[model samples]
Target: MYAIVNIAGQQFKIEQGQEIFVHRLDGEEGAAVEFDQVLLVDQDGKVNVGTPVVEGAKVNGKILAHVRGDKVKVFKKKRRKGYQKETGHRQDLSKILIEKITF
Candidate 1:
C-alpha cells in the first residue's frame, strides 16, 4: 500500500520502509509522527482520493534524523554599475521512514 501525505505544507508520495527528507519537524530522532492529511491512498489495486484530505486516513512515520541540505548560492549583479551581491543558503530537513498507512 502507498499514500500521498501532506507534511509541513508539502505533499509526498510515500510507501512503507521508504526514507524521505522533508522540511524540518520539531521532534527528536526515532520519534513517531502521524500525518492526518492523507490526500490519496492505494491498496490492492483500489484507490481512494479525497477532495482535500481523506477522512479517517493517516500515514505513520518515524523520524530518522535531522540534517541540512546542500548550500545554494544566490548572486546578483548590475551591469556597468559595479554592484554585486552574493548569498548562500542551506535548508533544514528531517529524514523520516514511512512505517504504515491506515484508513
Candidate 2:
C-alpha cells in the first residue's frame, strides 16, 4: 500500500519500508512518529481520498537520523559601485523510515 501524507508543510507519497527526508522534526533519533494527515491511500489499486485528511487514517514512522541539506550559496554584486554580498544556508532535515499505514 502507498499513501500521500503531509509532513512539515509538504506533501509526499510514501510506502512501507521506504525512507525519505523531510524538514526537521522534534524528538530524538529512533523516536517513533505518527502522521495523521493522510490525504490519500492506495491499496492494491483501490484508492481512498479524503476531503482534507482521512479520518482514523495514520502513517507510522521511525526517525532514523537528523541531517542537513547541502549548503546553498547566495551572492549579490553591484556595478562599479563596488558593493558585493554573499551568504550560504543549509536546511535542517530528518530521515524517516515508514513503518506502516493504517486506516
Candidate 3:
C-alpha cells in the first residue's frame, strides 16, 4: 500500500520501508512520528481519497537522522554602481523511514 501524506507543509507519496527527507521535525533521532494528514491511499489498485484529509488514516514513520541540505549560494551585482552581495543558505532536514500506513 502507498499513501500521500502531508508533513511539514509538504506532500509526499510514501510506502512502507521507504525512506524520505523532509523539512526538519521535532523529537530525537529514532523517534516515532505519526502523520495524520493523509490525503490519499492506494491499496492494491483500490484508492481512497480524502476531503482534505482521510479521517482515521495515518502514516507512521521513524526519524532516522537529522541533516542539512547542500548550501545554496545567491549572488547579486550591479554594473557601474560597484555594488555586490552574496549569501548562502542550507535547509535543515530530517530523514524518516515509513513504517506503516493505516486507515
Candidate 4:
C-alpha cells in the first residue's frame, strides 16, 4: 500500500519499506516517528481520500539518521558597482524509513 502524507509542511507519497529525506525533524537515529496527516491511501488499486486528512490513518517510520543536504551556492553581483557577494547553504535533513501505513 501507498499513502500521501504531510511531513514538515511538505507532502510526500510513501510506501512500506521506503526511505526518504525530509526537512529536519526532532528525534535521534533509530527513533520512531508517526505522521497522522494522511491525505490519501491506495491499497491494491483501492483508493481512500480524506477531507484534509483521513481519520484514523497514519504513517509510521523510523529515523534512520540525521543528515545534511548538498551545499547550495548563492552569488550576487552588481554591474559597475564593484559589489559582489557569495553565500553557501546546506539544509538540515532527516532520513526516515517508512515502516507501515494503517487506516
Best prediction by lDDT: 2
Candidate 4, which ten residues in sequence have the lowest lDDT sum?
A: 46-55
Note the Cα lDDT for every prediction shown: 0.94, 0.97, 0.96, 0.96
lDDT of 1 by residue, 1-103 (tens): 8889989999999988999999999999999998999999999889999988889998889999999999999999999999999999999999999988899
lDDT, residue 48, model 2: 95
Q: Which residues of candidate 3, in runs, are more than 4 Å off?
A: none
Question: lDDT (0-100) at residue 16 of candidate 2?
Answer: 98
**Taking the candidates one at a time, how many backbone clashes does each contain?**
0, 0, 0, 0
| Candidate 2 segments whose C-alpha is farther than 4 A from its true place | none
Instruction: For candidate 2, list the clashing residue pairs, or say none.
Output: none
User: Candidate 4's residue-wise lDDT over 1-103, tens digit each?
Assistant: 8999999999999999999999999988999999999999999999999998989998999999999999999999999999999999999999999999999
* Per-candidate TM-score against the hidden true structure: 0.96, 0.95, 0.96, 0.97
Query: Who is ahead in lDDT, 3 or 4?
Result: 3
TM-score of 4: 0.97
As for candidate 3, its clashing pairs are none
State which candidate has the highest TM-score: 4
